[model samples]
Target: MGQTLYPAGCVLDRTGKPVTGFAGMGCEMSSEAIVRAPGAFVPGARYAQHRAEGANQVFVDVDAYGEFYHDYSPDHPMTMMRDRDNRLARLSLGMTHYQLVMGSENATAWSAGVVHYSHGTAQAHVSIVWKVKNDKDRFGGWWPSDRLPLFFKTFTPTEDEARLLFGAADRLPLFDAVFHDSVIASDRWEFGLMKVSGMEGARFARALLYGTPTIWPLDRQEVRRTGPWLKAAHDDFRIAHGWNAPVALTGFRWETADRLVQTTSFADGRTLTANFSSTPFQGLATHCVRVKRPEKAAIDLCPPALPTR
Candidate 1:
């Protein structure tokens, strides 16, 4: 998992000491997890709550990304996850994505972080945690098939922010909006997943992390399901007997789209029988996105960039 220090410029850590370097990069490839250290350190309080809710929180800073496409390499899929259940009190926003990727070609250490999102608030692997130490650490390699599928992210930004940025945002490069959970967990303290989408956008970004070429076919379709507990928790967060917070869990469903590949776009009304691939806050993110967003697979397998333990 990649990680970095937050606040843009060099900063101090909790120890009151200057951070050793511009940023640190880490990858738990086996588990498909990435964590980067940010300039600003996240408060211990936030980390504590993240541990409680079972939300994946790292001491690293993270950035978000999008997709781009081309021939021989159409699109790659990515998955994202975040702390959407209000597990941590430090961030009091509307489950927005985080890690805006302040600087791409500028940072001395460059940008370091995990890319790809699930658009999901709590789905694990959907918010893909690359850099996993072993096979058990990950759900499995993200590919597309009726038996197995991948997920990646996509989002629709509001007009105001787009105007202020003076750009419509890159279809490939991902900004650390309020939604990227990796950033929220650390409070911009440490962790980085910096890099823009190549010709394939987020798809190519996935190629960078997975260390292999991802192939997205045609229609980009998905299906999703929710755990009973998660359904129970989201509807009534106030119920005492209910889960202390929304918990990340796994479920399955049949899916179809103009494409039949992995994706990070999200929808709430999804059911076990409905079709879905990713979440909203994080959008369609999963290693599978590269594989899922299309209807057919050519059997071209790509390897991870820094496959690690």
Candidate 2:
């Protein structure tokens, strides 16, 4: 047994002094402390690296988890892999025993099998312009208004920003290829359905291409305002792609300077083709689509019925 029964300890800086923040809020307990003192479980640490130019922080690389490390204190020497395994084992046990569905905030590739759903994988972060223009308060305290702010409702990305934000170069569906059938991935709750207003079409198209669910932060007013479109969008996706079909194959190619086409084939033998070049394929742009199967009739995703607001 350790000297202290309480596993929690003060986090230290490179100089071996406690890392104290405003109102004494920066302290954290390491997993090894629990192991040594309580003989309980370990929880994984976040990824950290040494600052090449700064002396305020010194990095400790553990052998088990590569560059990741726990607190530098001698009493807290647990590796991140051990911690990760311990946490995931608990999750597995809960799922098995309670018939529960597991989910996490933003799941990495290693934790995909354990978590049933995840946010922040599909639409990660917004551009700096969007943040500055919309969220004047950094804490995201601008809710409970009459309607959505004008910037949130109508702000469209410029051509350069569009390419940077929603362009093919950075937008890849690698996560969906492996775990779309098992894990339901969606945008973060903060940036749910109506938040990405001008980029609605591109977001929906990408959701279809990636075979993930859409996240909507709905209120009574929002329901009244966008109800029909939301219903249609959900119905379209449910009908076209069910909740649990694996993506068997995918293809992406550029037909012309402005035109790009992507296809996602599901295990159920349906192939969805998204045409990005029918118009200016920018961040605020929309795409046309056609779904094909061996015996089923061709389904077209065109201008009228799809959600564009």
Write down the worst ten-residue block by lDDT for model 1. 187-196
Count of residue pairs whose backbone atoms collide, per candidate: 139, 0
Q: Model 2 clash pairs?
A: none
Instruction: Report the C-alpha lDDT of model 2 over 1-309, residue by residue, as the tens digit.
Output: 234533345444455555453347654444345445544332211111112233222111121112233455655644557656644554554345434555665666766666677776676455654553444443243453755443234344566666665665456677777777777777665555555435666666667766777777676767766687577568768766765545554554444454466667777678776766545432223465566778988776643343433
RMSD of each: 21.9, 9.9
lDDT by residue (tens digit), candidate 1, 1-309 = 122322222222334333343225331121011112333334334445555666653322222212111111112111322221111212221122332212111111112233222221111222123222113213223344543322222222245422222121221113222222232111010111111121122233232212221222223231122122222222322221122322221222224442223223212211111111233212333222222223443122221232111
Regions of model 2 farther than 4 Å from truth: 1-68, 124-156, 168-170, 243-259, 278-286, 302-309
TM-score of candidate 2 versus the correct structure, residues matched by position: 0.69
